[model samples]
Target: MPLVAPVTVHKISGETLTEVPDLLAVEEPLEIRLGFGPITDRQQRSVSVTMRTPGHDEELAIGFLFSESIVQKPTDIISCRHCVQDSQKEGNVLRVELHPDVVMDWSRLERNTFTSSSCGLCGKTTIDAVMALTPGPLSADFSIEPAVLHALPERVRQTQRAFAYTGGIHAAALFDVDGKLLLVREDIGRHNALDKLIGAAFWQNWLPLSQFGVFLSGRIGVELVQKSWRAGVPMLAAVGAPSSLAVQMAKEAQMTLAGFVRDNRFNLYSEPDRVIIGQVMAFKA
Candidate 1:
């Protein structure tokens, strides 16, 4: 079966009602687990279960672990696989085996890692809770012209294969300064899409993505900004407006942030100096 599910929908326009077949982005829960041993004894524990699209389960799980600061490097993970523990499994549980030498911090695991469609460092008191996980500043050398920023939305739209089919998924793409699409991932959860992208990069030894910029098909949220910052991405552009917290993180991290990038127009929320306006032609939309 395709990752996207086809369903019948009733459309009501003016006074006429018609039933039509429509595609929906599939949503399912994936349980991420950790397994490790001390040469003689073995251990297994469940980390988190998040609602996400069906594909890229390993990438999603690894990305979640890295984003949440559970693990920093790709080598920290020994391997990943599907595990069935109970009747509810249905191939939805994933087990990530860490290097035996690595010590998993139970305290750092936090209270809970379960995330719904909308997830982040929740139940923690203040913004500082999120800021505590913030990564260091990114390199200031990599840059793109303001004109290129304006062209990104359309360029990214050209590669949204899943969104075209379902019209119900969010995409997160990585692009070079010249506006070339490096990678893109789509998911029902916007954050999950980004996680998959970052996790793929992590597995490919593509960390410290200092020269790359991220483009999101949805509004910029706090967790999205935090995740991008943690991954060392210097620039982030979103199709919709950014939340106040997202903007605040951008400023503190000194990362370039843009939003509402449509019709050749965009709003630079932070680190505006990073974009070189003189290099390309920029027209207001």
Candidate 2:
């Protein structure tokens, strides 16, 4: 069993003592470095230094790059490797070398400090600052039923392995057009879970997930919507409600956004045309 170092409190009663475990919050620092070689006159930029869990650092880096729109194609990334300048110390820094022909949009590169789950949009300076770096609209034309959206929560709940253990993690899952779960990742932070999932897809060379849909175990926020947009996900569903800004961004990005999905009931916030209401269970009933 995977173990999380949880803080415990002990209480002594009149007869016996009791111990209770608290949420385990671990902080590990990871550095991200961009490499394009010295020949192209492109300087290696240290983009972000985030405090996160030690596991899945590479995937986190790749997902962060994709979400930031730094690289489009998987081929654009030559390699992602861990570097340790000294033998005695364990380095959490990742050096990502891009293809010689690939060029990064440095003007849009933001988020210079630490990113916490509580606030995924803090480093963003302005709306234009974020919109300027986002990728184009999704290419998929599939539709999902409101009933299917409603059934997502049950499916996600059953598939949460880490949550079952620690009861303190969030998850992001990829579902096919048929509503079958494809991939799921859990992390202490909702954004981290999505990052891990997107990073896994990029590692498999599965660029542009417009054909598939993304489901979140939490509320739909602007940052999450932007990440899905950058990944080319045509439709995004969430168990909780979506923020007003998230709904606006989804509509602007031409992506289907659904929320309040739970117990076979959900509301279509934007692009209802992508949702086949007639195909949903609620309509059939």
Candidate 3:
């Protein structure tokens, strides 16, 4: 399906109102189902239904599962494809078949009831519940220069095809230490965008993304930080501010967190050493 659709809107400026053609980002529901158990007795479960821009559906499903700790590695998945219902391809429904040997966790599927484009942890009972899933403090081995950090948002913006037309989509991108853009994903949801990026990296066996940093097109939420930390990303920077819990989570995980990363400046909330600055700066965290 197309990521954007055509629309007509009134252009109101001063006393003049003219109808002009415009584009809007497409938003649709994607149901992610999981197929697990032995070959003799297979079972399926509807895991998540999220509203997202219609593209890269498979990546989004895999990324969601991985970030939530449902599936560990790419090999754990036997196949991932859209489902066929009523003798027709159901574009909105996707199924991820897991390897038979992988033990299925029935409890994990309960927390994710329905995910929206704007929020990721809508169903979690507590912050500690999500915090327990972290793999521990990330490695402090990665580092990038301040100049390189300042240039990432624009670089991500340059490649955002959907955002260019609709101006309503969110994006997530991965970059190397020298400020090289490796991968980018766009969606109506900030969390889905990051999920797609992580899904792509996971397919390429790039977990434990210790040498790279993730950049977001929006605010850095605790969920986004958790997703990045799960992928082993050492640093995460966003164009907007980070919530208090997000900062605390990053500090606890020892991951670098930066916010307000635009117009040639950014604020480092934690693990400031990852961003190379000439002088020592004191931070309470």
Number of the top-ranking candidate, with TM-score as the measure? 3
Clash number for every model? 0, 0, 0
lDDT (C-alpha, whole model) for all candidates: 0.83, 0.76, 0.87
- Tell me the tens digit of each residue's lDDT in model 2 across 97-134: 88778766665564422244355553334344556666
Stretches of candidate 2 off by over 4 Å are 1-3, 10-17, 21-25, 39-43, 85-91, 111-131, 279-285
| Ranking of predictions according to lDDT | 3, 1, 2
Q: In candidate 3, how many Å is residue 40 off?
A: 1.0
> Judged by lDDT, which candidate is best?
3
Query: In candidate 1, which residue ranges exceed 4 Å CA deviation?
Result: 86-88, 111-135, 279-285
Off by over 4 Å in 3: 86-89, 111-127, 280-285
In terms of lDDT, the poorest run of 10 residues in model 1 is 111-120
The lDDT of model 2 is 0.76
Per-candidate TM-scores read: 0.89, 0.81, 0.92
Q: Is candidate 2 or candidate 3 better by lDDT?
A: 3
Whole-model alpha-carbon lDDT for candidate 1:
0.83
